[model samples]
Target: MARRGKKKGRPVSGWVVLDKPVGMGSTEAVAKVKWLFNAEKAGHAGTLDPLASGMLPIALGEATKTVPYVQDGAKIYRFTVAWGEERSTDDLEGQATKNSDKRPARAEVEALLPAYTGVIMQTPPQFSAIKIAGERAYDLARGGAVVDIPAREVEIGRLEIVEHSPERTLFEIECGKGTYVRSLARDMGRDLGCFGHVADLRRMEVDPFTADDFVTIAELETARFGEAGRGKPSSDGQAPQEEIRLPDRFEDIDALLVDTVVALDCLPQVSVSDDTASRIRLGNSVVIRGRDAPVEAEEACATARGRLVAIGAIEQGMFKPKRVFGG
Candidate 1:
């Protein structure tokens, strides 16, 4: 018998800003989008918890190469913290382990915000995805083991209370990578003497992608189906309710795809010539001679004819290709 090769899907490429629905895990959502696009490859920039919903940047095919750029960008989250109850999972997903009778006043809560702002140390929730000794901390916690996750420093660019009520307080935070909103709620409750857990969470922005760029799964499905005309009529002579249509060609799904270069928008750009692009594609560094080249930057995106060629550093008037695109 001969070995068989794995089946490959279409070579669909680009980013899809999915407005993930609550209760769907990040992996599940990625799989759904991958299937909907029938893409050969797929990945996501950031992992959003099942309880939280909002902008999830999904990269298909070549766009997967730009995931790290988007992941490293700043993130904004709006969450609600319910006072008086602490859950094992740090959110509404786990059992309540503690309670409190005290609710901090609006002024009091505002006063404590400064202490958590800027750079601060935070301990991740025990029931989290953090790995411990080759095992996930959450797995150990679920098995009746006391998981002690280490505290690490995270940057909070901005933190403010969006709303405050007697039972819960809504807050919005802009933070750098690795900052956990659930942990923020947990620590705030501890600081106020009213143990708390996240009641609800929604990510509003992830770097280049904002609320405006988000596309609901329903909308994506409708667009895919509407373009593919895969909807079939039922016995009632009405078309069956279609969740999404699977496109047969990559061009058919162009409306939903975002250019790969959009992920590198934060970096400085250097315009190169066609010859320079060819050299970069061949893993060669080219001397910066164009007028559009950035004067100075730690890293930059090189484009030729308005197409992303590479992302690399410029040294001594030379553009080096750390990662080449469209190769």
Candidate 2:
């Protein structure tokens, strides 16, 4: 297949909370949405496996600048673990390497949840995106190389059983960044002595964005090109029916894009003066002094005239722009 050239698009900045469908890679989904919106620059906050689905927050234009903050936020995922078989990839996509007839009872699973909660050590699956010597771990594993991934501490706020069957167990987990649901399932299975793998997974929320904010691709298409369908026949039953025409303009697409400030909602907001905002934009630091100014050393979102100006730190009354948002 011949490679297609990139499309020339306007500078459209904002976040799109896409209810991504399963069986699509994160990169491919980002590309599709970028093309649909004709955005000049676009990126996604986190990677959802081709088998996983749900809230994939895509950052377009200036919104991409805040992707790191969003990615660092907590995430919620509901996944299923299929017992009796452990796969090489820790998910159904890979070959089974071990099996067992043992199945942990509901009570037994409940007792084990506490051990996995809080900060626990988790070894990422060999077939993961983690880098090993500058190469993807999955790529190395697929090439039949023995990959040894060390266990790292990950914070899990919550891990509970939503449902449990003889063949599979459903769980919902609220965890911090760098946590992998597949690895959780694998470790849980090992502890229960059933040897399992992730059968299904869906991210329900990612910090600031929840399932309620997600929009399907079809909905986006309709928003871009309004309700364009053949009108029904009149009472008199005329010839056929005229098609409903709707405005298809760039501004129409903009309506669907969320404000970039939504990504920084979790942080404290500091309203700055025009002069301070301009100085920050010019890569200069300004002193923030006022009753509402953030106290102590911490990160804050600086806004001027109701628009996000910069994300920076406040230390000793000085606000240093760590990442500035540009139009």
The lDDT values for all models are: 0.85, 0.85
lDDT of 2 by residue, 60-156 (tens): 9989998988999999999999988999989989999999999889998899999999999999999999999999999999999989899999999
- Single out the weakest 10-residue window by summed lDDT for candidate 1: 231-240
lDDT of 1 at 72: 93
Model 1 residue runs over 4 Å out of place are 1-7, 227-252, 295-297
Instruction: Give TM per candidate.
Output: 0.90, 0.88
Task: Flag regions of model 2 displaced more than 4 Å.
Answer: 1-7, 228-248
RMSD of candidate 1 to the truth, in angstroms, is 4.3
Give every collision pair in model 2: none
| Residue pairs in candidate 1 whose N, alpha carbon or C atoms collide under 3 angstroms | 225-245
lDDT of 1 by residue, 138-169 (tens): 89998999988899999999999999997899
